[model samples]
Target: MDKRDLVIRPIRAEDIGAVQDFLFTQLQELFAQDGQAAITDDVWGLGKTYLEPDNCNMWAVFTPEGTVVGTAAICAYNGRIELLKGRYHLPTTAEVGRCYIDAKLRRQGIGSKLVEAMTQFCKDHGYRTMYLHTHHFLPGGFNFWQKQGFAITIDQGGSLEIVHMEKIL
Candidate 1:
């Protein structure tokens, strides 16, 4: 895909539906299993969790025709930081989440662009590090984040091996 054909920017209010549909269609199994209650808990709270905060945001990559092809987001890291048993300071960290690209658009640098935008946003807003977790289940998941400079902090080697990674800005 030609780089010039895509537009990457912070998501606007009007782009919410396209983002939801794009993500739902891409990861139907996860969302459908819960009857999409996850969307209501997360995507539906975008305004309070992302848009309205100075250190949080959600970005979307749009085609010229205005379809959402990719997305990335940063939100305040919540929960117990001590659970990871790492030297992480929660106040200086932002959680990187909701990163996905259209299946047809992979390997064309769209995901990297979205991550770049998120990292730059994190840097500008005074976040010292970005954190994320991924499992082996998603295609290209570990390699993608590793390429973006995130180092694996923990690899739970059990039935459900979730990998937690972090990148310092």
Candidate 2:
């Protein structure tokens, strides 16, 4: 497909179903390979977690046919991490996640576009920091965030080896 044909924009109510399906499939594939995965509440409740929150938003990359091929989003921190509670105000921090591109469409800059859109959203919404966690098992996941200016704040080494990353916006 032509890279020029892909469009990235904030998702609307009508796009929720497609976006959720895309996310679930991607997570399932990753889990099948690594034997670890949890589809977050945000994935199941995109409308409430993303669409309903004033400071949260999700963007999807759509094909010319309007299929959701990529997604990225940010939501209020809401005390997900005790480590961040003392250092940053919960409301002013955004937790970034659901950043995935269709495997066939990877490395074509779609992920960067989604991240760019979310960063812009954070700036417009007055967020001071952005946080995200990616499992080391995901190929290039950590390196990708590093390229986007996120630095490792914590690396929980265990079965999943969750790497928590953050970027100051």
Candidate 3:
């Protein structure tokens, strides 16, 4: 089906299983090319937990007929509260991750829509800043994040060079 027949919306509770399946499929495809070291149980667990509305914010892209086609999540983090001090030190910050669109629907604007939706979600959730990390090797990921106004904060070498980017909300 054409991507134009799709709609994007907040993830519903009933959609969790489908979202997870989509996520696993995408991850498997990624690993098939990059190798298994890139996949981790922790990452899988985190994705599952992040779908819970109370724990994290997520958005799902679905076909007009109701099939989920993409998913994104904003995992929050705060750098201010000195754990030793037990006090707040800085504004809330969030890390955007688990952004995956069905391979067939890529380049059809679904990815950008998901990012924009997540950014709005972060803003509504009171996040003062948002950050995400992408590898330099993922075809167009680095450039795409840059186009979206995410500044590169770090670059580490490997088959995949980690590139961190952030924007203040």
Candidate 4:
């Protein structure tokens, strides 16, 4: 199918299984795990969070035929807010949980659509800021975020291999 066949929309409960399948099966096959092990079904209460009428939700890019190709999600974050001890952060009242696009469809703006939908979702839900982390190793990982207007709030690019980025809504 062509890019014109794509449709961006909010993710639903029925789509969870397919999303999880893509994450565990398709993604695992594409990446070199290096014995790090495949992903498990335990998603730290993702299903419950999605089901709840809370600040957490997911969005997907799909074909007109109903094939889900990409998704982005967020969850309420009541964890911590150190880093600055002030209101300089992205509000960071919520956390960007998962965002993924099909390998063959990278750079075609599907990811951007997902991110846009999620950011709008946060804004509609009264979130002032959103925080997320991505691996420095991924190709275009940092640039994609930077291009999306997400600033590097915290660069924990040490041995952890993750760089935390935030977008002030």
Clash numbers, per candidate: 0, 0, 0, 0
**Ten-residue segment with the worst summed lDDT in candidate 4?**
35-44
How many clashing residue pairs, candidate 1?
0
Give the TM-score (vs. native) of candidate 2.
Answer: 0.94
Name the candidate that leads on TM-score: 2
Local accuracy by lDDT, each model: 0.81, 0.87, 0.73, 0.71
Model 1: lDDT to the true structure:
0.81
Quick one: best lDDT, which candidate? 2
lDDT over C-alpha atoms for residue 164 of model 3? 69
Q: What TM-score against the true fold does each predicted structure earn?
A: 0.87, 0.94, 0.81, 0.81
| lDDT (tens digit, per residue) of candidate 4 on 37-128 | 43443343547766475777877778787877877778776555465446433344677765777778989888887787888888888888
Q: List candidate 3 stretches off by more than 4 Å.
A: 38-48, 51-55, 78-91
lDDT of 3 by residue, 1-169 (tens): 8877888887766777777788787777765575644544534564466765453777889888787788788866645323212222235677787788877787778889988988887888787778777887666778888888898766766666777677877
Better of 2 and 4 by lDDT: 2
Q: CA lDDT of 18 in candidate 2?
A: 97
TM-score of 1: 0.87
Order of candidates by lDDT, top first?
Answer: 2, 1, 3, 4
lDDT of 1 by residue, 1-169 (tens): 6667999999877777788787677667434442332344567666777788888999988888888888889997875555575566777889998888877888889899889888888888888989998765567888999999999988875544579899988
Runs of candidate 2 with Cα error greater than 4 angstroms are 83-85
